[model samples]
Target chain A: MKNTFLNKKNLTWLILGVAFFFLIQLLIQVGVITPYYRVTMYWICLFAILGVSLNVIIGVTGQFSLGHAGFMSIGAYSAAVVLRSMPNLTGLFIGMAIGALISLFVSMVVAIPTLRLKGDYLAIATLGVGEIIRIVILNMKITNGASGISNIPYLISWPLMFFFVFVSIMFSANFKNSAIGRACISIKEDEIASEAMGINTTKYKVMAFMFGALIASLAGALYATTYYVIKPETFGINNSINILVIVVFGGMGSLTGSAVAAIVLGIINNVFQPLAEWRMIIYALALIVIMIFRPQGLLGTSEASLKTIFSLDTYKNALKGLIDLVTLKKFRVAAASTGKGKQR
Target chain B: MLEFLQQMINGLSIGSIYALIALGYTMVYGIIKLINFAHGDMYMIGAYVGMISVTTFKLPFVLALPATMIVTGVLGVVIERIAYRPLRKSTRVAALITAIGVSFFLQNAVSRIMGAKIYTFPPVLDNRTFMFYGLRFNTQQIAIFVTAILLMILLQVIVKKTKVGRAMRSVAVDQDAAKLMGVNVDRTISLTFAIGSSLAAAAGILVGIYYNTINPLMGFAPGLKAFVAAVFGGIGIIPGAMIGGFAIGLIETMVSGYGSTLYKDAVVYVILILVLIIKPSGLLGKNRKEKV
Candidate 1:
């Protein structure tokens, strides 16, 4: 464990991450990053955290969960209720903890039964669970019904948001490389084979699901603290799909991809803000186009590590791909027809 | 007791609409194993078309229903050709996501074109109420039930006795084998989509006339409920979808009548989870052991 943490590559990444964080903080202090942009940054970080956590379930564990926004609502509401009375950093922590606990419990209740189903069935089941959560919240008195809860103190800062984003990405990356993650992947590849090999499929699936729910709740807390109000409408199926889009666009299994996609998509959202009415239409079209052209996603399960980013071979391959695209040479090759074959 | 009977009648009308939509879901799933998330949006389009035909084109009610079905059916075929056919060999999740994208696209596009305001469907059918044994029934309710049953019966005949129906069945059973036997797999799939979409369109018209209000987002809730019905009956089974639809309709009506109206949606979802847990294969589905 010590060797893994103290390795040269790990040390370099840590330094880079800290340096980047400080750089962003310095920019915020200097007023170079305006308040408007800061809000956008907060959203990017929240989406990044959400995408990474959901990646643990969908990409790493190979389970299709569409109820992420439900868990997020739990955190947001719990935090809002707690902070309504306490309105302090300690209260924030307490609220986040409560949210995580509730999400964990709900996820356990949902995952154990639903995980036995596969693919579209699981997706629909989770979607139903999410809708049910939203409906319950909608009818609840404490949530103020459809009007939602307001007067929430904006306690979450840029640093706190960034810290949580970093922690979530780090945790997801480490989990992906761990034994449990491998077990989850094995189950994803073939549940029966993994079960035959003595891996407890249900236990690993439940663990991954719980982990996802926990992180989603934390992000939810951050989200609630950033905004002044929390509404049940915000945590509907559409919001869940929004997070799923980030994960899928980033490349499912890659944490780095999720973060990058979140930032990119967040910027796209900002750019399209003027055309608010057409935003969803364009977003839907983009989803269909991307699925048709590159179903594996932007990175295609490959992480953008320092080694790959800095390597000459990586750029060379990219150049070759570009040339191939322009020349239509790739399409002409019969042997290269399969979509998955071209990923590597 | 009279109120209970009234609720049951109401349930039957609503359940018939659900059955019509569920048939589309089941037929598509039978052929491609996809949930076709956008299937519900087709219902919305159908409603809009029905409204346009009746209000703008000034078509009679009898003619408007067929016009709506034909338009939605063609759109379904076009959607299948453009979005789904390419992803037929891809991952189920990919196809599912694309279906969702299509659904969102359809909803937003229609909303943009039609505006978000709720439009009152023209009361083509006379609002005549019939009373029998202290039970009240409306003409619209009777029309919806009768139209839905006629469509289902027509669908049954087509699927059971026609050449295209045979092709669809064979394709669903084994695509490659059917292809080997000279079945046009692509065309068969397209036809399946067409037929399924038309049924959903009929339901949409029935709903518009029955409810008296139509909106761009109207298809979402009913679509979900219909999907639940499809699963409850056995996702790919025809009779199963029909049975499931009526059962869900009755349950929903009964819940709202007896319990809080707010909990009706929640109750339907709970039923979905319970069905999934208790018998994932559904009421009429045959359990096939997973193969290695």
Candidate 2:
């Protein structure tokens, strides 16, 4: 009877979570929201989706990709070109879905041959692919050459965006709590050990890449349909880097960290409009500072959870505040005594 | 046949500029694994510095050449000290992203200072042509090819013969071991950037002369192509970049001349894809044993 009551309480929390998002959707539909806040929320949702997609590769898999924008470019242009040829609303939805699917297919074809390559080579291969995509699109008559394709489909509405964003975040959260997520983290922690332990590192690596590419393509499709325009330059290295920055700035291996980072960076981007030209400089400085002072990121490798907030307070009090403890802290203190962190 | 020769000449000349810039990527990638995305912007800076030195300071061309190299070299070392040195122990991916950030900062700062408009460099090269069998080699083109080869030889000698070069190779081979051996990894890295930047400076001045104009963002295309070249020649190998540079030049020029020039990047991208799929270690790079 007590267990049944506990299960009922968990069901209520899940329903409440659904209701909270439902309320936000209702507010938008009822026209109680301003366009400014509405647009910002829309971008935040889109980026949050993209950030989680990126987490599969950068955060969990422990690999770097400067080519994510290239995958996105594929989706954006895929949607743009297809919907133009087939403009029925259902056809457009099919196009967005197909566009994302095709991207997964192509990335798999590319990833299959190249994921086996050594460290940083994969990064370069991906980067090269990204550039190739942009350059090829730039020259394509279908893309209007340098002029870019316009009028994709303004048919994408706020409700659609919110629904897709919720689906995206939920998928990522669920992945974090699943076997696939554990497999990715295992590969990241030690590939050799994981392989020795029969984890099939290569399969996990390719799956992670495919999954990341799939989500990124979905984000690209959503962005394309909503904006009703797509330019090759729009999905350049800067887009990939921005996604990466959000991933790292949150926490490299944490899903919730990326969502929070995307939101913060999005707001920062909007607020710091005056620093447009100096944006890279600020980001570079921030990265350097973060690596020096807090390389673990704000959340570390741990995902954010309701219980984590309370655990954090206790952990802080038990270790540093209350009394000294053994373990890595003692080693760190010993290293400090030996003159670590003191520059010559 | 004459037209083919002309394309060859044209490609080799442009290839020289790419080769020169690629030396930076290959050399630094050789010692330190940092991609140094800002290396391209340093080329931009070199152009601006050339503009300032030749036009603003009113110096002779040859003197201004050395002057641009000096200033850009110092700037390269300073960036290493500031942005990268502290993050030395972090993951290579973090360093790569940071390099991109540094790149953005440099490009934007120059963009802000010089404005985004294209600025034409005053004609310092004599810009005359020598014709042979219907193929004409411009003074600038000849200069570019000759100077690039000379720089490659100089780089080869530096890496192969000098004590500093030995130290650099040592650090590249094993940073922790080199540090324990008292090789001063930081200083070697700075020197690597110094030499790399000087080469980029030379490429900048030549390209400025060839194009007769320089823009703030001019660094992006060439920078990327140089990176392509470095990879093509098998990164971390000195002679490979030289060959890769010329190879890229030939492909891009041939494609631009015969096919649609707009698809020039398509040629590079295809090569990149082919190289990665067929030979991940590159044509010249030997496979490294997995580090424990």
Per-prediction TM-score to the true structure, in the order listed: 0.96, 0.90
DockQ-based class of model 2: acceptable
Worst 10 residues of 1 chain B by lDDT: B85-94
Per-residue lDDT of model 1, residues B1-292, tens digit only: 8899999999999999999999999999999888999999999999999999999999998899899999999999999998888777767888888998999999999999999999999999999998988899898899899999899999999999999999999999999999999999999999999999999999998999989899988988999999999999999899999999999999999999999999999999999988988898899998888877
Pairs that collide in candidate 1 are none
True contacts kept of 2: 0.40
Interface RMSD of 1: 4.5
Model 1 alpha-carbon drift over 4 Å, by segment: A1-3, A312-344
Give one digit per residue, the lDDT tens place, for model 1 in A1-344.
36457888788888999999999999999999999999899999999999999989998888999999999999999999999999999999999999999999999999999888888889999999999999999999988999999989999787788789888888888888889989998887778899999999999999999999999999999999999889998999889989988988877787887888899899988888899899889878867766666665667688888888889876675455435434534332412243343110
What TM-score does chain A of each model score against the native chain A?
Answer: 0.92, 0.83
Model 1: lDDT equals: 0.89
Candidate achieving the largest DockQ: 1
**lDDT tens digits, residues B179-261, model 2?**
99999888999999999998998889888988989988889889988988998999888888888999899999999999987
